[model samples]
Target chain A: MLEIKEIWKTFNAGTVNEKQALRGVSLTLNEGDFCTVIGGNGAGKSTMLNAVAGTWAVDQGTISIGGTDVTHLPEHKRAAFIGRVFQDPMMGTAPTMQIIENLALAARRGQRRGLRWGLAKAEKDRYQELLSGLGLGLEDRLTSKVGLLSGGQRQALTLLMASLKKPKLLLLDEHTAALDPKTAAKVLELSDKIVAENHLTTMMVTHNMKDAIQHGNRLIMMYDGRIVIDVSGEEKKKLTVPQLLELFSKVSGSDEADDKLLLS
Target chain B: MTVFLNALPGAVSQGLVWGIMAIGVYLTYKILDIADLTVDGSFCTGGAVFVMLFAGGANVWTAMLAALLAGMLAGLVSGLLNAACGIPAILCGILTQLGLYSVNMAIMDFKASVAINVTQADTLEKLLVSLRFVQGSVKGDFPLWRHPILVVGLFTACLIGVLYAFFGTELGSALRATGSNGNMARAQGINTDFCKVLGLMLSNGLVALSGALLCQYNGANEINVGRGAIVIGLAAVIIGDVLFSKLFRNFALKLLAVVIGAIIYYIVLQAVLAMGLNPNYLKLLSALVVAVFLSLPYWKGRYFAKPVKRGGAANA
Candidate 1:
């Protein structure tokens, strides 16, 4: 469903603060695959997802979504086939806009916008039905400005918006990191339900080891701008934190996994 | 008291004319989330276009339309500088405004000022608005259309109505979304650059129209007519926002608040003049008022803020 070929991105190149975010990283996802990505800080997991999302032009790479190369497309143009939920809750939606309006915007994702009315009477009813599915009571507040919503509600709304038009690839960038535990669990569950129902190809970045292991059909660990270990299906189901650490230590040729990775 | 009363009608009419320009500022400042200084020049460009075209024996409406288009062209330059050339929005507007001084001069036949030939044999009957008509209407000898308050008031209402509807449409919503959140708008494939450019065009078009009307009312277009125009517009917007934000919940009513704010501003200016203040100091007074109003919200949030109490008293 998505392909990344030897992508490379360097920030502040030729400067004192130069840092290479991605280096010759390549990965491909099969159709209907829900992949969970994990890494320590600066592991390039998020950078890899951004590369595929076309947040900026990678110094070197070719990325394709559903067999169409989109590496050269600008961020907004590439949005035609990509759905993104950012790490910051505020980045995913317009705060000053209303719930129905936000959904209506997402409904036109990948489509040309014209002089038609932004919100049709029928669209409100449909958004209400979709919001009720989240069980957040959002349907009751369709016209309320999105800024008034709690973080979880907003993320859930963002999730709904991202999947409104069924993009070819959905990118979730630590979407639940800022939420309270209960709310994070609720949002994660909502993400799972939406992706499953839509049969969407998804790449979800997470900080929690348990979550990375528990959700998704496959899991990949990134370290120093490269994928160190990838486990899937039967192997992924049997994987435990300690075993995963041992595998990471072996594959990364490191003495041991860092405490931050274990603790997180 | 007599001086103040005598200035009231003139203040109201001037306020109504400036109110239109303030509405244009509201689009960029409040809607597009930009403070476009381009109006400082485009306002004069509007007057220059109107006066120059009307003097060339064109129809009055044609002159007005040309003025609107000229203002929009000025906006297009600023918008491209900001969006396409990668300059900051404020800087882009400043650049366009600076360049427009020369452009406006050229448009006015390289003259620093120009006037409508109302005294000419063929001109006075074609004027859409004028101070003479305003005086005639006050004496109850002219038609209702000749009243500045009525003519400009009706025009403002129509402009507001059209804006209110336009903002509710898909393209308009995309523009609003772009202003509110560019990142999210792009994620939705909104082509926000196009929206920004279009918004500037729409905003400056209205500003030029306001300028055209002001020129007609004053019977002259001076190069300095647009001086401090941005401050006045910002003052109107901030005043309207501070005063009527809570009372006016509807979009159209909010726009009306801006117009009312301009009227209040002009009425206050009239009072200051009645009190014997120098006319040249009026711009200084407007700047101070805007500065104070702009800082009010920040001051309230910082100085008078209540502590955020937690659920438990101990947590507070």
Candidate 2:
């Protein structure tokens, strides 16, 4: 469950580079709701996800997750309730660290790290089991440096890490955008399986319209820093590319969809 | 050649003493990914604190402990400036290092140097390690166990063992994660700022401990004793990494390589001095050596790197 109320964020205010990234945006997601977000460049889709993640304080409005206000909380503090997978595969895992070490870090999310040995003998079996489930054969490379993994593998590991502690909400910001078509599809499929298995409430920002349609229970399209189109339940299940494009044209008052939105 | 051979023991002993400081630099430089300039000041701060307390009748261990604490305090200031005040990491270290000059001077009663009255038999007898220990052991006047090389070698071993264990702990792993990927660390709920500060404290504490030992060994703590200390520390770390990174994959062995690197650095310096190099140019030579070694990786990547063929023919 997540609540965001009229959040406003502006970057570089009073400067020539000023841009309004978010404009009085509000959205709510019920428990176990997986929301797919779609928008062209500079449409604030990623900005909205970042606001919920508390990457920075919004200029106005409040946000809460699982019934607790996190508007004033810092990014790391808010991490207790949120799992994040970044657009860049390198951003989500420590490259110089080992695979198991990264997983161990994720296991202790929201908990104080003390002087105990980082990897307990008992937890190794559990980690190997989880890695095997990824079907990437990472279980055999527990001590291998994560830097050596492929981009798709790293993204998959990041997804596992994000869901390791079962946060209240998982945020995926174009997590597969950097991978090749085959790898991207694989990672997306992995994301769906993981989210479904965990019953995780998720907000996934994607540029691909087909992916936007093919995944998640609810769909929202952002335009000009605001949510221009939102459809859910039976309405979303029956939606197609043409209908979504027509709705975007109606709400955005544009004869054609943005080239990126249409083409991507 | 005979002179160089005769100087081997002293060079090795001095190298072992400085190896401790190099280990401290390794923690911040390699582990925390910070180039903390504070060690240049904190090194003298340790020596100053040790000499003042020891001359004032404190026990040897108490004085050394005070030295380590003084160094840790210096690191804390730099850490707070960088982490809490959000000053740039390099600037924070520079500020703390500059401030520590005045503090070190005051600790030594505004003197340019402080001596431990090593001419006094009681003072000489009380020192844990000294230049005299090397000669006295060689001459069989003192027990071989009292040799500076042996004592300092044991110190380095213990330090490496402790660091290896600490780095394997949960808190240490978090610190490693902070250095390797700060964004990932924060998302995993690690307090990265806290880890950075803690690392600086631990690093400077060891540096100061080395400085205290050096002051005892040299018979005096000079105001300029710590000048170019960071360069020496960097030289040791870079040299060790270049030469032994492949061979020493284990954490404890890696630390051992750093100490060995320091020893090798001193031995080379001794050899150059034996070949009639002017002592005044020593710092310049050290600077150039470190600068060259530091640029090797960049040059290798920029100029010597070859095009790679991936999963196909070379032309393809």
Candidate 3:
């Protein structure tokens, strides 16, 4: 359950480098909705996610999650209701910290940190169980610094951390874009399983059209600064690559989608 | 050899005193991932606050507490400048350190330096630890607990124990996370600004306490006492990290290593002085030693270590 209304953001206004990143964009996601967002280069897809995450305040418009307006809330304050995974795996976890410590931090999201011991014994057991569920053998090395983990491992760990506290809205900004196809697929599968199991409302951005189509219940295509195509239910399942491109051409009237949009 | 032997006790006691300050340095330099320059000013602020308070008839304990508070306030200013005003951490600390020079002078009643009336009945009897006690404990003029080494060693142990416990707490972990990865900390809903401020406060509090002890031991608080203090602090932290980082993985032991590093640093200084090195070159020597140690890891990794392919899912 998340809502965005009339969001507009322009970077470096009235200068040579000025670019309108987001222009009057609005979208709403119902509970348990898993939406895959697809767009070519500079489609404002990631910008939309960052806006919801409150990385920077939008020049105009409001965003609300679970019936609370977070338009003016700082990024960290907005973190109370949102879980985020960045494109860079390094961005989601402290590399020098232990795996269990990272999970422990996630577990206490939206809660005040007091003088209590950081990681409880019971939490360690629970974290091991969670790690085992990933089937990555991370349960055996809970104390190892996250810096030693491979990027894929870090990404998987970040995915687990994001949903550890069951955020009201999960935001994935090209979360698996950097991984190899096999690892990306595995991570995507894990994402689906985790989101489905938790009934999490999620918005995932991907450049690959197939992932945009093959995953999630709803699909939206962005061109320029606005969502131009919205498909879901039977229609979303029936959509294909050429058909989606045709719709993008019909709406945005730009053929810039040829190379950047992955047909496979 | 005789000169070295005669100075060993004083050197050891002075080392123990500075070890507490090194622990304070470690909090910012290692834990918070900040090379805070504010300690240079706050160190004297502690001595100035303590000496002025003690001279005005306050008990040593109360004066020490006041000094600790003064140091925390200095850290608070630096933290606000860095975190709130968006100044860089180094610049914020430098500004605070520069401003504190005048503040330290004012605290000494516009004098560049001040002394404890060690001859006065109140100042002498109310004192906690002093350099005189270093030889006094040997002659049984005072109890062993009054010895500078013993008193400061106990003080260092207590500081380390409290820091070890504090860092094990949830709030402390949050602060560590903030320094480790700000993005992750914020995503975890940690108020990173608050954590940075709290850490600076904690760090400067210890630094000031060390300064209070230093002034008491030396019998005077001078304006230049804290000059280049950051270099010494860095020397202790880097030395400990270089020598004991692998052997001392536990947090408490790492702190102990830092104190041990300070002792070793002072012993070397004393040895160099005894070996006919000009005393004025000590700061330069300290800076060079720290610089070399700081670059050792980087140079080893950059020039000697093998590069590996990064980012494979199979590696997971």
C-alpha TM-score for every candidate: 0.97, 0.98, 0.97
Q: How accurate is candidate 1 locally (lDDT)?
A: 0.91
Question: Predicted candidate 1: what Cα RMSD to the true structure?
Answer: 1.9
Those runs of model 2 whose alpha carbons end farther than 4 Å from true positions after fitting are B310-316
Q: DockQ (Cα-based) per candidate?
A: 0.70, 0.71, 0.82
In Å, residue B70's CA in model 1 sits off its true spot by: 1.1
The models' CA-based lDDT, in order, is 0.91, 0.93, 0.91
**Top TM-score prediction, candidate number:** 2
Better of 2 and 3 by lDDT: 2
The collision pairs in model 1 are none
Which number leads on DockQ? 3
Taking the tens digit of each residue's C-alpha lDDT, what string does model 2 give over B238-265?
8899999999999888888888889999
| Span of ten consecutive residues with least summed lDDT in model 3 chain A | A255-264
lDDT of 3 by residue, B145-258 (tens): 788888888888888899899888899899899989998999889999999999999999889999999999999999989988888888888888878988998999999998
Model 2 CAPRI quality: medium
Ranking by DockQ: 3, 2, 1
